[model samples]
Structure formats: structure tokens, C-alpha cells
Target: MRESKALQVLKGRHLRLEEPLLLSTVSGVASTKPALIRYFDQKISPIGIITTKSFQVTPNPGNREPVICETTKGNFGNSVGLRNPGMDQALAELRALRQEWKFRCLLNVSLSANSVEDFIMLVEVFSEVADILELNFSCPHAAEGYGASIGCSSEISSDYVRKIKEATKKSEVPLFVKLTPNVEDIGQVAKAVVDAGADGLVAINTVGPIVHEDPVSHTPILQNTIGGKGGCSGRWVHGKAVSCIKEIRMAVGDDVPLIGMGGVSTGEEAAEMVLCGADAVGIGSAFGTVSQKDWEPYLNSVLAEAEARLKPGKEYLGPKSETYLAEDRQMAYRKHTVTKIAYYGKDTIILTLDGSLPCKAGEFAFLWLPGIGEKPFSVAHNDPLTFVVKKRGPFTEALWLLSLGSDLYVRGIYGAQLENERTDKALLVAGGTGVAVLPALAQQLKEQGTEMTILVGTSESVAGKALLEDRLSGFGSFTCVADDGKNGRVLDLLNGLSLGPDQACYLVGPEIFMAIAAKKLILQGMEEEKIYLSMERMTLCGIGMCGECVCGDRLTCQWGSFMRYDYLKEHAPSMVGL
Candidate 1:
């Protein structure tokens, strides 16, 4: 439509963005949870704009596990339920964010609501710190009355946008309406919102409230009200996004700001956004491409690539600062055959797959059963890839009953590696199914030449605890006790436990068990830093995109499955409370 120009000015009330070729996070993936936002602020460049997850007026628990997953086509579909820490906490977080970054990076606060009045109310409150108030009118899988309800209809969208914009005119905050492509006439919806007075347009939120199934089991993945259907994004929808942005540009006129995003992983793809008349690129699922440890350097390269490929008023923005080497790589799944299955009675079983997985102790992996679903399990044994599955629900039940030689889809080996620090000794405590996490750790300590002692607790029904006793005993020390065992349970073993000057204690099980165990160790004069505990959460995406595995500001999928006690006490204090 016109010559490319520098995208330096994002223009909310004022734009302090440092880069010309614009970059912003698409809400719901990267920036959410106040602590996560702070982590990104420290790592992400000042040029990068931070967008929050779509926060509602009240707190949202979001969807159940199997909330987000990958499609066979390498795309992602999520029904994350617009989870957020209600407005009250959000206000304090946004205030703290200001203190943390001090406006070094611009904040685009995203809001979602069912009504125009509620939207307007959110703008008023969030505008206090928001450089740009992003109105999320288009989350495909959110509960009814939320995102898609406002975005799918031009009449509904126009009326709402006009009202919200009218209310915010005095606040002078730029209202960028996020649009969905699920509508029949997306351009019409775009024109209506723009004519009503949106300061900017974020084209194409996700396409299709479609269903993703297990390839064999056909079990639906997303846990939303709509029968497991979700919106698809990533490389699969980039074409749709480009087309939507182009149509929006045509409908709104060349002067309006547009952020085109979907499957933007390369300089060429970023160039496609600009060519389609986008002022900025919205990066969504591509954030899943890099693990959290590599979040900073990886994103910097993507930013450099986009900046290098663009032009501002006929001046070629050349010399990309960095190369996106990992663009071609994705967190992938490998197929394995369930060669061995061991039953610990009806409730618990061990499933071992053929071949080994490359993983460190304390790291975990996700196991997928096509047509069934995917769930994360601690790597019980990396070599021969074993998992001790306890029948918790349908997911584990399927695993427990799986026939030998059946296939297993495995991905990850994700999370922080437990540092192999040689100490005077190592003490391991396991409870119920949590015993699956210890063998690999025991192996690590044994290899380090550190003395090892293991304590395990499980159901009384599993009478013959031979497997549990045998595996851990290989590491030098083993003690197993059940709920009704004569040994007075595993907790009894902790009483007057001998203390080593430089021993490390790794405990995994239920929260109460860990808390009480930690308290006992502390009472026994153990160092808090020397005590490590595995924090379990519903993990999806293996990476941090799903927001289900956050332990404080830390993404447990990356920062840890096992974090030291001192760190948890400060950041994840909820774990410390009995």
C-alpha cells in the first residue's frame, strides 16, 4: 500500500520502544503471572514490548490439564481458560513491574471481559500503568461470553469498541483490539472496530475452534466446555494471519497500526508481516520453540531478524544482528514401544518403553497416547525409558492397562538439571507415586561417589514392594514403608535422623509430606539450601507457554522440577506452609 516505514513509534499514549521494526508478545503465552513478567523484563531487551495474558476482572482458574498440546502438523491448540490472578493482584503486579523495569520496556496490558461496561472498567483501572491497553476480543477457546463472543460479530464488536474507546478517550490510552479469524467476514469485523475508533489492530488471534485428537485413541485434548475443541496457531495459520492482516489493512486504511502474527519464526516470515502492511509482528506459538533457558538469546535473534528484513521509507534495515539457528528446530516427540509393564496390584504399575531417552536426573518428560491424551510423568528410569504410573484418573488408568509392545509417544526431558554437587551424603525421600522421581536422582548421586540413603512411602495395598525395594537398593541405601507398615511410616525414619555436615536432601511426594519433612530436617539443623523438593504442577507444552507449571515466577518445566528449599520459601512460599 505504501513504502515501508520505521515501526519505532507504537503510539499508545507515548511509545518508548527502542527498535524500529516492532516486536510484541501475543497475550496468554509468555507474559503472565507477575513473577514471569519480571523474569522476562530482566531478560527481554528494552526494545521488546511486553504483553500480559488476558486478565479478567476476577481470577480465573483456567482449563484443566491437557489444556494445550501439539498437533501432528506441528501446530498448537490451547484452551488455557484465560487464567489470570484477578484484578487486585494484577494492579499490585503491574505497579511492581513499573518498579522492576522502570518503563525500560513498554507494557501492553491485555484485558478480557464479557461486557462493554466491564471492558471499559478494566481500561480505567489498568490504564494507570499500561502504555497500551490491548482489548482481547478474540480468544477462540475461552469460556462463553468472553473473547470470541465480542470479536466474531461486526455489530457486537463495533458497538463494544466504540463504547470502550469513548470511555478511554480521556485516559488517552491506545486501545488495540485483538481480532479473531473465526468470523465469516473478518474484514467486516475489522472495519467495524476501526470505524468505531480502535487505535490499533492485532489481526488473527487463532483459527478454528477445531478439535485435536489422539492419532489412534481419538481422545480429545483440550478441556474446554466445547468438547475439547481449540484454536490452532503456529506455522499452520501463518497464511491465514497474513491474509487477515492484509484484509484488515484494506478495510481500515493504510494509516492504522497492525500487528500481524502466526507462525512467525524467521526473518522472512517477519518480512511477510511487514509486507502485509503490519506495523508490528505478534509472536505467539513461536515462543514455544525455545526452552526457557534459551528465551533471551533466542528472542533477540528473532528480533534482529525482523529488524534486519524491514525497510523504513525506502531505507533497507540491513545487517541482522544475530542468526536464528534454532528456528528450524522444534520440541519434538519420539515413538517408543512399551516393552515391559509391571503391576503393583490394581492401583499402581510400571511401564517401560524400548530404547533410552537423553535426560538428566530431576528432568521430566511428557508421554502421549494417541486418541487418549498426553500427560507429564517424572522420568523413573531414563535408560529403557520407564515410568511408574499410579492410577490417579483416566490418563494414568490408560497407562496402567497398556499392553506390552504398544506404542508410546514421548517428548521433552524438559526442566532444570539438578546440579551434581558432591556432598558428604545424599538423602532421598519419596511418597506414593512420587517414588518415580528418585531412582534417576539416586543414579546421579551414586555416580557422583556421594553416599545415598532412600526412604519411600506408598499405599498399603501394594503388598509385594519388591520393585521399589530393588531399584533404590541398587544405589547403596533403601528403606520402604507403607501407610500401615510396622515401621511407623517413612516419617518415622526421619526422627532423630543423623545429620551430615554437607548432606543434600531431595524430597518428592505430596505437599504436606514435603512440608512436614522439610520442617523436620530444618529442626534437625539441616541447611535450607541443602534441602531440595520437587514441586509438581499440571505441565503442558513442556516449555513455559501453557502457564500451568509456574512455581512462583519460575516455570517448573524449565527452572526446576526440584528447587532448593530456601528459594521456594521466598518465591513459592505456598509450598513452605504446612
Candidate 2:
């Protein structure tokens, strides 16, 4: 009798550090090219397997803001629109990973397409860099003719898997088929793909394209929700994931490798997956709760817990000295009372709260109104915590009507602390309501003892110039742009200013405005790397879990809201478009 190949462990090829547990990170957690490649650089990631988010044949801008909402502990509903940089860019990212990360982990590249021909083509090309190729057949909310369309039918899934395996057979890269649980029979689908030459199988994708809405508004939160439905994962799918794995194992027997995932957040759950018939467990929505720094220890604890659960009478291994995900303050919300609301014009106002959370320049915080909805806003002042709110949407309109001393909930300051980039002279440019990120930024420059000039541009009437100048001009020389047949536009003022290599500019505003400003600075002889543009967009989850906050390839929530022009040009061109 011999040990089945299916039961074979995923031992590190080069890591001699004993038999490490087989832990894998699902796509969309460290999904982007920069995040996936850079996260493993410091070896902070303890997991042995990394799955790239499903890359399409073409780039997807994803859905609009409010694409993700946390429904319960370790569970949330999301409609990220299957966002990815498409194939060519994704290939470049994988190539960079080859050049940078030489660690002892398996690189799993996941692919999604409408037809078997495209799937085969992807396999032929990506097999060059992939240790494993995961076929994403189970994304519940993907567009028609893709994902669940192929996964729901055993014949279509088998056909796709068979052709892809044939195309990449010479490459010897392991082929894993990820199937949907929304099908008629999980076992039949599992049997079909395995019989078609799937080397392994990943049981369960998201459970449903279920609708999650704000209680009071009775309106949909996710922008791409079709018929008001988005994919459901995390705590809600735990039981279904376990049962699906059990059915998949019973159907395929103990000869094929299987990865079970769905709402798996704890060690006990991981153990349960294995007992039911999973070779390795995949973790997804749980990452939504853990901050970037805590990813390593949290996974380590889950791995430890999974191993412990297997032992019949295991003794208590004592407390985990490393901080766990549940304890991370990033997820907790603090209640605060609204003390003051400055009516700086009808649209722009400064709302002050009694308490504060640790925030920094360029970072943002989420304000949640019970029974209403939550939205992210930049903190202008931290002590007695103040926010510069622009009355744009329903959320801001509610804030405008909020009575004084009303209780409100707030959490985070998401991005990392802004590092002081020393310069002889500095330029601060802001437009419209983007002035929120300016005050804190000005404060930092002032403390650095660096000479800075501030430029404010507004679409609104410049009649309230004194009110803004009173709060802003204290840092350095200040100029307001008013094109009222008196003063020319902000660009005209920028044209007359001095520009040099030794000067750094921090610019944030409307995307087109910032892009044009960055281009102007570069044209005026400032170094491209010296100009930092705010990359904040679609920031629903304060953490990078939702994949909604991605601006180009970088998730601004974790990668810092302000990025240099040189970096953006090569990675995110739209941020510096001409």
C-alpha cells in the first residue's frame, strides 16, 4: 500500500524549516501585481501558497464606489466587478514576481474567460511562470457567458478543463479547477472536472450573488449589483463550504487534490474542511478583517489552530503573543458626538466630533450613521476630530442636517503615515473639496521647517476666500484661484510660480484636475518623482479587503494615498495623464 498522491503535502521546495503547514491566500486579498509581488518580499507572509486574483482578457475598471459591505463577522457581500489588469499587464506583473520574489511559496495564477479557447490560450502562456493554474469557474456575480455560466454546467466545466489541461500538458503545471456551489450537484461537477484531467479542485467559490442593502435607505450599496445582488462570502458561507467539500471528496475519492474555502475564518473551520475532505484550506473574507501588518500572525494562528484541532487530546499551547486579527483596532468603530459644524458655504462645511482616531495626512476615515450608510472622508483636524465634508451624496447631505451633539460612529485612518519628503521648497495644490487632505499635509510640511506655498482652487464662488485663508494660510505663502474677471485660473497662477528639481509638490483634487496639475509640474522642470498625486478612489473598506479602493494597480488604502508621479506613470498612467 502506498500513500495517495492526493494526500501528498505541499512541502516547500527550498525552505528546510521543517514540515510547514499548507496554507494558501485566495485571490483578491493580495491580488494586484505590486501587492502580490511586494507583500512576499519581507517574508512577512507565512502562507505557502498565493493565488492571484482572476485576471481577464482585458482590463476591468470594476464597479463604482460602495462595492463592498461587511454583513457579519468574517463575512461580507461584495461586487468588485472582477477587477484586474487583464492578461498582458498581469503577465508583466508575474514576470516581475519572478525577478523579485525567490521565496519558498507556490505561485497560483487564476484565470477567467468566456470560452474554452481563451482558457486554453491563457494556459499555454501563463504556464511558463505558474506553479499552479486555477480556473475560476465559480465567481457568482461575473458578467454573462463567464464564471458561473461555465461552472454551473458539468459539461461546460469539463470541456473547459479538458482543453486547458491538454494545452498545458507539456508544461507540467498543476491544473486546479475552482467550482461553484450554486450548481445542482457539487459532486457531479467535481467528478466531471477531475475526469477531464484536473490535477486538483478548489471546492466552492462565493455562495450567492445575494443583495445586501442599507437598512434605512432601502437602497443598494454595491454599485454593480445586478438586480441588487452581489456575491456573498465569509461567515455566511462556512457551512456550505464544508458540505461542498464533503460532497466533492466523496465524488472524486481520495486521489485528487482539493482546496476547500468559503467563510473559513478559524482553525476549527480549517480542521473541519480537512476532515470533510480538503487537502488544503483557502482563506478569503477573513482577510477583510485583518490589517496588512497583522496578516502573517493571524494566518499563523489559524494554521496553528488547524493543526491543534487534529490532535485528539492536545494541550493548551498558551496565548499567542502575536496580536490576532480580531484584536486589531483597525476594525473597531468608536462612538463620538458631533460638537460643531462650520457652515463654510452650503456645499463645503467642517464637521467636528468630540473624539478621534489616529489619523495622518492623506489618510481617510469612515463615518457610519446608524440605519443610514457609511462613507469615507479625509480628516482635516484630528484633535476634537474634524472632517471637511463636501455635501455631495445622500451621506453628506445627512451630515449637513445632523443635529449637534448627535452620536455618530467612526473608524480608521486607513493609509500608512505620510513620510516627510524633505525639500528646500514645497508646493501644495488643492482643488474643490480635496482641500481636506491639505491641512494635515500643510501641518507636516510646516513641522519639517520646509518652505511651502499653498494653492487653492474652487469651482464655487471665491466669496468665502477669507474663511479658507484663515485656516490654511498659516503654513506658508497662500494663494487662492478665482477666475472672476479679477484673478485668472489656478493653472495661470501655477504658470507664474517658480518650479525646480529641489521642490516637491503634493496635489489632490478631481482626477482630471490632479492629472493635469501633475503634468504641468513635470513640464515646468520639476522631477516626475517629486510630484505626489492622491490615488484615493472607491475607498469603501478602510482595509484593502474589498478590492474597491484600487487606483490602477495599487490599493491606496494600504499603499498610501499619495504616490509619486514616476511610480504612477509606470504602474498607473491615468493618475498622470496628459
Candidate 3:
């Protein structure tokens, strides 16, 4: 399976290295930094190295406190307060990596300065030694006059990128501006950089100096009592990253190529980034998957697998499922029937299609709204595709505008199956639109006349209650809660609906609600796998092409739109956007 054109572009550009490969640095081992070099060398490829920070002649100590920690929220936060070994030492490290590596590395030299002269001087020093000079306009953790201090204010970031572009006038060395995701609208900042003559954009430099605590102590883990949360990484950060890439791609069009990074762990992850409009994939956490010895082999295997998965000629990333559909008439339209359609309000509608008899109980169908776009919606009914949608945005709006006889586009009978139906009576919990899939499962149980109970949580919206009433008419038993007292509170409903230990549970709603519910249930001694839930992330590529819809290592569009509560709890912190 050859790579789709979107992926080929990313893998095509070859960065030239200096010398033979060497594993001289283990300090950066946790990041698989060396394997990046080895990946380029063995693969005979050319990619850039985003070098660590370096200041001007004057040295500055970054945040001098606890930089990293694990939080109860299941995420890592660090206040690596701009700790650098000074310019001379930093230059030496870059020189060493340059001298021994096979492919020529594009040095994204990061530097912070208070004045124009300071930036000029640093660029002067790295001009000869470095490939691309990245002006550090977006480090959220820096002191006054540096990092986001300069980048956040468009005027400052623009002036700095312009100055550096002029200083490197003699050389065409591309100057990239590492933008901060902390901004209200990152696209506006990206536009500023482009106008300032930045060669390209390196979006989102982490969410913040997030903090993890000692579970027992229940106190802050890091010494830096205050942390500027940087870019959210791991699985949670995927959608945010994609959103940034999409905004930049939309704003810039094709004038400059994008180097997308953040939360990418596999080749498929890399492929997804490309489809959302990235030229190359910057992998950092992927190194965590393999050991030092297995780095080369791991990179090789993932690269091969990713290449095989992509389509032949699509500008976007992933396997290009839509593109494939365009080519083969036989593959274009799949057959499905609308089992049920419930209109909650003028804008909100729930449609349960039929055709999922071939799939497992919890599997989902990829709902494509033609020109509108695509998203992975869990099967509300399952015979076909039962979706509860509100006229929220473009896609959902388009769905609302759709009539019953209108043609609907859909793909993928994809997702994990409920391998063993829990003979243990089941408990189903839903929130808002989360109840879309509950009806189908309920219908199945009702037909079989099995023991099942459903609990739905919603806000004080009549539409929500209306939809719930329509869907739960035939279930074993049903309860509805409206936060505003119109119905009842979700918590109230749950408290009222009791079940014994021999019951499996499924939860689908807002993340916080599910988290709270799962945590409470676990304390009640329920098995982790007994509870399941739905998570909605940015699902750019339905076939798991774009890693946009990720929850830890799994693609919500592929492995799940439905996942075990235990799995989610384990990866929740890292799975931020859920």
C-alpha cells in the first residue's frame, strides 16, 4: 500500500545530515531525540531538528523549579522555566549533533532577547551553524520581554520576525515563528508572523505549566508554584493541534508549508496531521513507544505501515477514504435505512438509520454530509446509522437542513465490538446528544426483552427532554434529568436509579459528567470494563487517517467513538480535548 499523496509530500523532503550516525546523547533519551537522527540516517531522509533554546551572549536561567509532574487529572504539567545551558554550550550541542548525523538537520535554533540587537547578535552567531533560524516569539514560560511576552502581542511578534528576516537578509535561511496556543485566536497570530515575513509556522508550544499532585498529599507536585501551562500534549492535545493547523492552513492557504506537531505517536497520527494541511510531521512522544535499541526498527515499522495505509493522490492526509470513494463507483454509496428520526426542536433532530446488523452492538458509522464535512457518530440505533444531531455548526446545520427523502452519505461500519454481551444486566447513561445511540441498543434489548436501564442527563432545554422521551419510549426503563429542574438533575436521576453489582454500565455525555460518574461508580466497586462512554474530538479523517479524533493511542473514529470507561480514566489526563 503506497502512501497517499498527502503523506508522500511529508516524507519526500530530505534533510541532509553531516556525518555518520552516533548515539552520543542519552540525556534526551526520554524524548527519543536520538532516534529522530537515526530515523533520518537509516531511512536516508532529510528532516529538521528543533534545537533546544539558546539566549544571546547574556545567559538567563529558565524557571528554576519543578518543571514536570503527573496530575490526578491524568496529564503532565511542567514549568521547565526556560532552562538553557547558555549560548556557547547550546551551540556546542548543535554542533555535535550536526557533525555526526547522516542527514543534514534543519536547525530550528530558538533564542530569546530583550532588544533588537540581542536577537540580531544571536542570529549572527547561529547563521553559519544553523539551517533555519526560528525566532522565539512564543515561549509561554519565558520572563519579561521574551517567549509569549513578545509573541502574544501581534505587533511585537511581527516586529521581531521582521527584524530577524531582515538581519538574515543575505541568507535565504527560512525563519519560523513558534506560535503559542495560549492566544485567543492562534490564526490571527499566525497571520501576523506571515506578514512579518516568517518562513513558516510552528504552532502551539504546549498548554502550560500544568501541575500533577501527590495523590496522598493532595498538594502541588512542582516546586514552581505557578506554572504557565504550555501546549496540551499526549492524546488530548490532538484536536487542538489540528484546529491550529486548520486555522493556519485556512489563513495562509498554500503560500507556506506547515510543519505540524503535538500529540502525534504513530505514522497514522502523522498522516492525520498531514491531511489537516501539514507539510511534515514533527514526532516527539512517539519515541516513548519503543526502547532505545528498538528505536530504529520501531520508526521503520511505523513508517512502512503508515505509507501502506495512505491513498495514492490526495492532498489531505490519512487513507483518503473520501478520495477512494470518488474513484470507485462501487465504493461510493453504502446502503442504510433511517430506522427512526426524532425532531427535538426546530434545529435539533435525531435520526436512527438501519444497517448495523452486520456490526457489533457499540460500533459506529462514519457520517459524511457531502460538501459540509465528515464526523464519526456512534450508532444510536445500529441497524443503519442513528444519529442525534443539533443544528449547532456547519455540519450539524447541514444535517438539520436535510430532509427525510434526501440522500445521505455514510461510510465505515468501523469500531470495536462488544465481544461478550454482559449477561450482567446493563446500565446505560447518556448526556445531551449522547443519547443518540442509546435507542438502538435499547431497541435491541427490548426486542430480546433483556434487562436494561437508561439514565439520560441534559441541561434545562426542552429539546433535550423531548429527544430523550422519543428515544426511550420502548426501553426496559428510562430516566431523564434536566439541570434546570424542568426534568430532574442527572445526579438526582442516577441516585434514584439503583443497580446491583452484577450490572454493566455505559456512559455517554460531556467528559466531566462521565468522569465524575465513572469515578463514583468505581468507588462503588464496579469493574472498570463494565462502564463505557463516548468521546468527541476533532475527527478530520474518519478512517483514522488524521489522528485528530484521538483518545490516548486509539482513534475515536476507528477503535472508538465508544470506549471502556477504565481505558478513558487511565488516559484521560493526556486525552485532554475529550
Q: Number of the top candidate by lDDT? A: 1
lDDT of 1: 0.77
lDDT of 2 by residue, 1-578 (tens): 23322224531211222333476778765544555445543454557677888888788776654556764445677777788888899888788768765746677889889988888878877877787788999888888888899999999999888887776667667788999999879999999999998878887888788877654344555666376578888778899989998899899887778888888777778778878877777877777666655677777788777667676565437444234545443444567889987765547777888976667786888887754567888887788788877888877888888889987777676877676579988999887777778878887787887898898876546454455567788888888775444322676667746786678999888788888787777767888878888776756677767555665555677767888788778866755673
Candidate 2 residue-wise lDDT at 72: 46
Error of 1 at 51 (Å): 1.5
After superposition, candidate 3 runs with Cα above 4 Å error: 1-50, 53-56, 72-74, 96-102, 225-231, 312-578
Comparing 1 and 2 on TM-score, the stronger one: 1
Q: How accurate locally is residue 211 in candidate 2, as Cα lDDT from 0 to 100?
A: 79
Which window of 10 residues has the lowest lDDT sum in candidate 3?
A: 20-29
Q: What C-alpha lDDT, on a 0 to 100 scale, does residue 153 get in candidate 3?
A: 78
Alpha-carbon RMSD, each predicted model? 4.9, 6.4, 17.2
* Predicted structure 2: clash tally: 0
Candidates' lDDT values, in order? 0.77, 0.74, 0.56
What lDDT is reached at residue 283 by model 1? 72
lDDT for each residue of candidate 1 in 303-341, tens digit (9 for 90 to 100): 656555554443335433234233332345678899988
